[model samples]
Target: MSTGHTSVPEVLDALKDVTYPAGKEQLISAARQAGAGDEVVKALRGMPAEQYAGRAEVARSVRVDPDSDPGTDAGRRAGQARRGGKPGLSQHLREEPRTPIQEEFDR
Candidate 1:
């Protein structure tokens, strides 16, 4: 990782071989094994200690554009544009919608 901010593609590349729903330790280990530098590793360490289901999930956790590819410079620019310059993490953990039966019980 460079001294600058870590890119979403870079993080994803570091976790290419990581299993789904990976824990914090698993993610850090995978990133290290993939040759991630201190910046990238620090970013991973700062992420919420929870299981990530996929790259998209990790992207969201790190406040990157989940839809854009970070592999190329152009892609990184596109992702940044898609992000609209917003910084910090958004609400990733959401409550599941209740079924009709559950709603009725609440009522």
Candidate 2:
């Protein structure tokens, strides 16, 4: 568990400019590079091993609401604003055509 409360925005801010579908190592590296404090780093390190498609997924995985603004309903609306109506990275991945090798492997 984290020693301090690390907000979702804090983590996202720390990971600014990070590429999507990032692995744990890359996320941690980005956080460290951004000079994230111990709590933020600890939260990221404790996340389950998986590919993260976007900040929202990472926020959810870390148990922080990407839309929450500390202590208000305003946070809910803020999340939509943050996304700017664009689809998440996972959505793009889902629509992407599988490579020939991948398609063959599935067969």
Candidate 3:
């Protein structure tokens, strides 16, 4: 039942490129038990090679500085204008002076 090797360097070699955050050992164990070596190989089998350019560790981009003005009045107004950006054609028509033909058609 045993391969007769104490430490399978091949298994560790298979895990060379596999990386994860701390405190996710349960998932790693599950993958091994389920016959998948690690998350990298599991993901690579499911995804196209072109879609992934390999992995690297990087800091989070969403965490901005405390000194940055994220919700100032200018920021709020800009966000509001962006959210309500569609021009109102009906309101524009109401503001415009009517032509003689348009006046006749209205009556």
Candidate 4:
């Protein structure tokens, strides 16, 4: 996956004025009107043609570099900040089912 640093931010920044409940064509048009460069426009082009409920969905549709950060989530991607592993590997491998265990333990 490409580093998200250059993708989502640029796209979102270009789309800041866009309203929600937009379609593929609307997004592309808006992005272009907002003076988005080729990279942001190209990312928006890759999205599936459908009605988007909000910016979050649009962000989800756009591919971003998920593993570059070292936090507690998105660890299945490997090299992310995971909490556990065998040896000499990143700790946040996410080998365990995080949601179910956390849910069970929470109550």
Ranking by lDDT, best first? 2, 1, 4, 3
Those runs of model 4 whose alpha carbons end farther than 4 Å from true positions after fitting are 1-5, 64-107
How many clashing pairs does model 1 include? 0
Worst lDDT window (10 residues) for model 3? 57-66
State the lDDT at 50 in candidate 1.
80
lDDT, candidates in the order shown:
0.68, 0.68, 0.32, 0.68
lDDT of 2 at 70: 40
Report the poorest 10 consecutive residues by lDDT, candidate 2.
Answer: 86-95
- Report the C-alpha lDDT of model 3 over 14-107, residue by residue, as the tens digit: 3344444312243234336546544333322322212211122111111112124244455454554445432321111112345799999999
Question: Residue 55 CA error for candidate 1 (Å)?
Answer: 1.0
TM-score of 3: 0.19
Global Cα RMSD, each model = 10.8, 13.2, 21.3, 8.8
Give candidate 3's whole-model lDDT. 0.32
TM-score per candidate:
0.56, 0.56, 0.19, 0.56
**How well is each residue in 1-107 modelled by candidate 1, as lDDT tens digits?**
24366766788888999989898789999999999977778778767778777888787776333234334355454555554433334322222345799999999
TM-score of 1: 0.56
**RMSD to native, candidate 3:** 21.3
Model 2 Cα lDDT, one tens digit per residue, 1-107: 54456777798899998999898789999999999988788778767678888887887666443333343355434553454443332211123345799999999
